[model samples]
Every structure is written in structure tokens, then in C-alpha cells.
Target: MPNVRPGEKPEIARLPLFREMQEEQRERIFSGSFLQVFPPQLTLFELGQHPDFLHVLIDGLVELYATSAGRDTTMRIVEPVTSFILAAVVTDMPYLMSARTLTSSRILLVPAALVREVVKQDCALMQATMRELALAYRDMVRALTDMKLRQSAERLGNLLLQQERRQGGNGAVQLKAEKRLLASLLGMTPENLSRAFAVLGQHGLEVDGAQVRFTDQAALEAFSRPDPVKDDD
Candidate 1:
């Protein structure tokens, strides 16, 4: 329902196949596809649900989570221009995670059979798909490793520093999601997150609410580095 339509400028189409394919190939992929729009907080699929289509996320963020015995845990957040429920689509398994829209989004649905057809006929598409899956796996491994190897406060500090880097030096930074979600993503409880902020300040992180200013950029970066410790670990 939000402004999910392609703007005046030519849209990238958000599919690796779409980008590499010729017009005919593009047409083939879209032959029987459908575009659906969803509002923010919309749940597209629940955990353990069977995935019927290979969904290409054209716009907006999707939060993936899991629930068991009435307990829900946020897993990851997918930004626009990526596939949602990719693991299920690729392996023909029920979704291990649920996807909910973090903002208004437009999704392109391609039948799984047609997606397989494209993979077979188009070598580039197949390769790109493999690369995407591999990268996703690598990221999961890294996240797991970080969690296992770092303390909660350190992990939260690193997450904040990474976000600052992503936003090009932390001026007017935004979380892009609620604090609870962010806390989950960092593998810390909300109260722990608050303590992490205080810890960072003790270690020289300047925090003014959401807009964290760095009193000493070099000191902060050094502390955030993998092999260094400033005042404390």
C-alpha cells in the first residue's frame, strides 16, 4: 500500500538474473510472475510454512524470526533487493524462519518451477544464485563466530561501531528498526544493551542518545579493533 512502485528512473529490478538477462530473458522470468504490495508490519510467511514461490524483495526490509512454544526470537533482517525465504525456495523445505515486513514493500513472486527453469537455461543466473547462497552462509558463520567469541557488551559495542561505519561516520545515525529488534540482532537483551552503552562510555564511547558522538575517534576505533583493549575488555 506504500509507495512501492518503480520510480521514474529505471529501476534495477532487484534480481541478479534480471540485471544480467536480456530483455527476452527478463520476459521469461516475469512470464507468469506477480507483484504484491504489503504494508509495514505485515507477515508474509510464518516459521515452518511451506514456501511456494521464490520471492524477490523489491523494496523495504523484512525481519526473519523463529518461534517455539510461544517464544519468539528475531533471527535476521533482510534489506531490500534480496531474496526472502531463499533457503526454503532453494531446498524445497518449510521455512525455518518467519518473514515480516519492517516497512511497506513490493515483492515479486516467481513460481518455483519457473525459477528452476531459469536456473537451468541461464548459467549466469545459476552461478549468481550459488554465490548468493554461499555469501549468506558465510555471514551466518561470521555471526555465530562473533557471538561465541565475544562478550555481550563487546558484541553490542562492535555492532554499534559497525552501524556507525555503515552510516559513514555516525552523524545523525538511525537504527532502522526498534531497539528490541536491534538488541536481538546483537544477541543481547535490552537491559544489557543499555549497560553496553555505559560500558562503551567508560571505554571512551561518546553517546548522546541515538546520535552517538565520538569524543576520540582513534581511541574508539582502537578499542573496537579485534586485538586491542583500552581501559577494559
Candidate 2:
């Protein structure tokens, strides 16, 4: 991993959270921050480890998971421009879940102590942190509701629809992550996911390897029954 040099200050300052902070506050945080690149499948932090840094994914994917009875359950996928394990960092507690890279990634690590100190001294920073925390909590609630109420097929259909929207509402959607990882994200076994896809095929959803096409969007939506309040993009 390479350290962030002084010349990269401007680029680092461009990050949403950092951009909202005062110059001095930003400096305080950046003084303790460094950038690192990791290869895919590298564990960035383990469960129960001390939250020494607030890690922000600059690019690439990160998986947050909890282990139980020797099996790992995926909790969330951290996309770029987002911070992970912030609640633990803010509380000065151990990380409740382990984080690992899903692809080669660039990350910014800001010392958690500096983050807490800056939040204490800066109202803007505190408000920003609160907003981020609130959004994350809301997302968790939605995910729980989805898992509780939706069947495996419905979940997969809704996910495809969301991906379609992300791809500018085109009828064709491509899977960015592997199907096995997608299965983990949806809280289903790979076999179950395959079955789910097969079931969805009856409702105008076509799956050919990583590519999915919707033959009848209306019919598929009717089958998926996506609720705006519950379905997060």
C-alpha cells in the first residue's frame, strides 16, 4: 500500500464529508489520514477489532459480514464514497462485523480519535456524521423489512429492477458482482438464487449468465411488487 502524499490534499478534500468540514477541521482529520490500496479478498479489519480508523472506500467494493457458528453472513456491501463501521468508530467500540475487499480497492483511513475530536469541536462535522448515521440506520431497517416480507424470487426481481434503473431504465441489466456474492447479499444460498432466477423467468425476467433482460417490464414489476418506501436503490 502506498501512502497519500502532500500533493493529494486537494483530491482528498474533494470528498463529500471532508468538503463539508472547515479548513482547520479538515486539516486535523487529514493529518491523521492515509490512503491504501488493497487487492480483492483481503480482510481490511476483523470482527471485534478495535475501531482505530474510520475507513472510507474511495473506489471498489467492500463486504461487511458477521460470522456465526463458523459461517459468515454478509451484512452489506460498501460502495465508493461511503464510510464503513462509523458507529463503532464513533462509540470507540470494537467493530461488530469484519470488512473485506470484494475487488481491488482504494481506501482512505482517518484516525477514529481525530474524527471524534473533530466532531466534538465542529458542529458541521457533527451534523454530517449524524446525517450519515441516520441514513445507514434507515437502510438497515429497510433491508430487514425486505428479508422478512419478501420471498427469494421477489427479492431477486426487485434487485434486478433496481439495477435496471441504475442503468438508466434500460431493459437490459448486467451484473457487476458475481452471482454467488449477489446470493450472499440477498441472504440466499447460491442454489436458492438459481432457483429464484428460474422462478422469475416465468414473470418476463430473462437471465442468461450475468446478463438479465426484462421482456415485459410491467408484468415483472407486478410480480415483484416493489414498494418505494421499502425498496432502496
Candidate 3:
């Protein structure tokens, strides 16, 4: 899709991040902001780049990633109806990670200066920001624990379980992302992901290209042995 400038704006204030903010503060923050469209694989920002805007994802998906020593890894995937990279915008520091579009996306870009000012003047917005940042931190810790504790195949199995739950427990998982990107998010090479899939196949997972179904979910649960602390959200 071609990138569209702010043409038809959505109800940005209705989103959770902006909902608690005062209308006056919301208007002030959004007055200078604009909605933008981005195509898949486009980089929104890179590590160490100073942030000028706080991006609110109105639709579609984004990938947060970091790289060093000539390699890159996916840190997290941001879904719709949420804001991302708030720390840099609030602290007036450079971004610690880069963001890229995983799908054609709609985003609202609020000026960094206005965001800071609104947060200072609006207590509700400040409380909301603090809550989001706290959740983000806990989420990072949970992800780290999952990476450190689980084996590659175990992780893949648990991920399938989580996906099933997320998609309404139909016993099928239609992957919304490319296997390569999923592999990166799993902290494994694509080849390793393939091998992991093959292992899960022996257990209960049925892989049909991007689609997966569980023939014996009980068996999968046995093999994965998901911990509530790590797997529960």
C-alpha cells in the first residue's frame, strides 16, 4: 500500500493510552500530530536516533529489534491500538532499539515535546504513562525468563499453545507473520525454527505452511509443560 498522509483520522483518544487523558490535553497533543501509513519492512526508527514523535499504532503490526556484531534479533512485536518507545520520547534520549513495520500500518505521530508537556500538566496522562511503562518492563522480564528457561522446541510448543489461546482456542494456529520473523522473535535462526517445528510435529503439531493445528493438544501440553509464571500474561 502507498503511504497515506493523515487523511481520515481515527478516534485516537478512545484508545487505552489516550483514554484517561484530559480532552484539552489530548487536543493539544494531537493538534500538531498526523496519522501516517507505512508499508511492510519499512524501518520507523533506528537505535540511537533521537525521537521527534511518540508513535501510536492505530492498526497493523510492528517489530522492535536490536543489532550488534553484524547480527540483528527481534526483541518484541507491537500489535495495534498501543503506543511504543515511550521511554526515549519522555526522557528526551535516543532510542535504544529500532522499529520496523511487519505489515502495512497506520500510526499516529505525536510530537515528543507535546507528549512531555501533556504528561507534566495532566496527572491522568502521567499515571497512564507510568502504568504502561511498568507493564512494558514486566513484559520484558517475562520474555527474558522465557528465553533463558525454555529449550528451542519447548518454546515453539508453548508458543503454539499461546497462539491457539489468543486466536480463541480453535486448536488451529494460522500464523499472521512470516516464519522468518517468527523465528527471529523466538530467538532462533530460521533453520533452527524449522527443526523445532519438525520436533513438535512428532509430538502433536501439524504444520501446513503457515498454518498449524494440534492433533493431540494433550500430548503437546505434556511436552511443552508451560509454566504459569512464564506463559501466562
Candidate 4:
């Protein structure tokens, strides 16, 4: 059974899955779920553990990583209001990646069995989840393609452009992950990321700590020009 403190029900129900659910459904969910607060750097679940609960990140960020031998690679980052462990729970497999709190974070924990039951009965919930999964798949494809086809310099430049767009303009955009993690996400090593930053400066991308400024958008975009493919003809 999950540990439910007083006054947590309302907070838990405000999460996406419970927000749209009927009162009865919400009640059923709360009956089986609770909240957990993790301090910064805390490991929520280790790799290869069978995930018994679905985790909804309510605050701060969590990073997922995979390891072998003595080294590890960051697999993904989860932000607030997002959920994780869907694939593992749905497939009944141990988690392929371990999750750790990047900052102090609050997460709602619900039994995977209860969630499966709710998903089975609620068409809206099921459809919404499928949409989330689809977007995740698309992101994975884009990241893989970017890594395989683009030079490290181009990948770094493109990531700058993407962050600018995400921030609504190119003037100042902040990085959400640590430099090393961001390097991994962009499929570059830390030293390579530093070299790429110097290369970016050559192409007019200026870094100001966590914030990036595009001093010459045209030059940067020129350096990021797409390659022609047979399909384009």
C-alpha cells in the first residue's frame, strides 16, 4: 500500500490522469495511490527493477540513465506534469533505465495494476496516453536520426536553434539539463561538446552559461543546411 499523508488527495487528483477522471474513478485511484518526495540526486528506481508503481512527476526534473561495466549514459529527462514507466509497466518488464531526481522533486505513486484498470475502462484516458507515447516515439526517431546523419558541430548548432524556438525566440534560451547530460542527449562527449561550442562560436552561436544567444541566425542556419535526399527530388 502507498503512503498517503493527510491533505495529499487534492494535490494528487490534480494530476492529468486523475483530473479528467470521474469522482468515482478518482476515489478509486486515490485509494491505491500516494505521494513521494525525493531529494536532489535521489534514485527513485534503479535499473533492472520491476516497476510496481506508475510515477507522475509533479515537480522538478528526473533523469533516466542506463549503465554497463563502469560507465553510464543518460537515456531521457522527465519534466513536471509528465509520467514515466509506461512501457515497462505495460510490458511487465524491469526498467531498462534508472531514474534519479535532478532537483528536489515530488511524484505521485500509483499501483500499476490500478492504472491498467483505469486505462482499460476509460477511453479518453487510453487515447490520451497513446498520444503521449506517439510523441515520445517521434522524439526518439528525431534524436536517433540527428545523431546518425549530422556532424557533431551540426548537431550542436541544431540543438541551439531548437532551444531558441522552444523559448519563443532566439534572444536567450536556457538549457534544462546539465552540460554533461545535454552532451549525452545531443550524442556528443563532454570534451566534444566543449569543442562543438567553440565551433558554434565560429558559426555565430554564443553561449552565456546556461543561456545561448544566436548572434548570427543566418550563419548558424547556413551551417545547419539539410542534405538533399532522393526522396526530395
Best by lDDT: 2
Better of 1 and 3 by lDDT: 3
lDDT value, candidate 2, whole model: 0.87
Q: What is the TM-score of each candidate against the true structure?
A: 0.84, 0.92, 0.90, 0.86
The alpha-carbon RMSD values of the candidates against the true structure, listed in the order shown, are 4.9, 1.9, 2.9, 4.2
Residues 1-233 of candidate 2: C-alpha lDDT, one tens digit per residue: 34567888888888767777889888877777889888999999999999988999999999999998999988888888889988999999999999999999999998899899899998878988998898889878867877999999998898788779877888989887788888998999999999999998999988888899999999999998876664334
Instruction: Give the clashing pairs for model 4.
Output: none
Q: Considering TM-score, which of the candidate structures 1 and 3 is the better prediction for this target?
A: 3
Error of 2 at 144 (Å): 0.5
Best by TM-score: 2
Query: What stretches of model 3 exceed 4 Å from their correct place?
Result: 1-10, 230-233
Tens digit of lDDT per residue, candidate 4, span 65-163? Answer: 889998888888888887896778666789999999999998888888887888888776677667667666776776788888899989888767766
Model 4 stretches astray by more than 4 angstroms? 1-18, 225-233
lDDT (10s digit) by residue, model 3, range 1-233? 22223344347767777788878877776677878889999999999999999999999999999999999988888887789999899999999999999999989888899889889999989998998898888878867877999999998898888878878888999888888888999999999999999999999989998889999999999998776764333
At residue 155, give the lDDT of candidate 3. 88
Q: State the displacement of the C-alpha of residue 88, model 2, in Å, after optimal TM-score superposition.
A: 0.6
TM-score, candidate number 1: 0.84
Clashes of each: 0, 0, 0, 0
As for lDDT, the candidate ahead, 2 or 3, is 2
In Å, residue 117's CA in model 3 sits off its true spot by: 0.9
Q: Which candidate, 1 or 4, would have the higher lDDT against the true structure?
A: 4
Please tell me which model should have the higher lDDT, number 2 or number 4: 2
| Runs in model 1 lying further than 4 Å from the true structure | 1-14, 169-172, 226-233
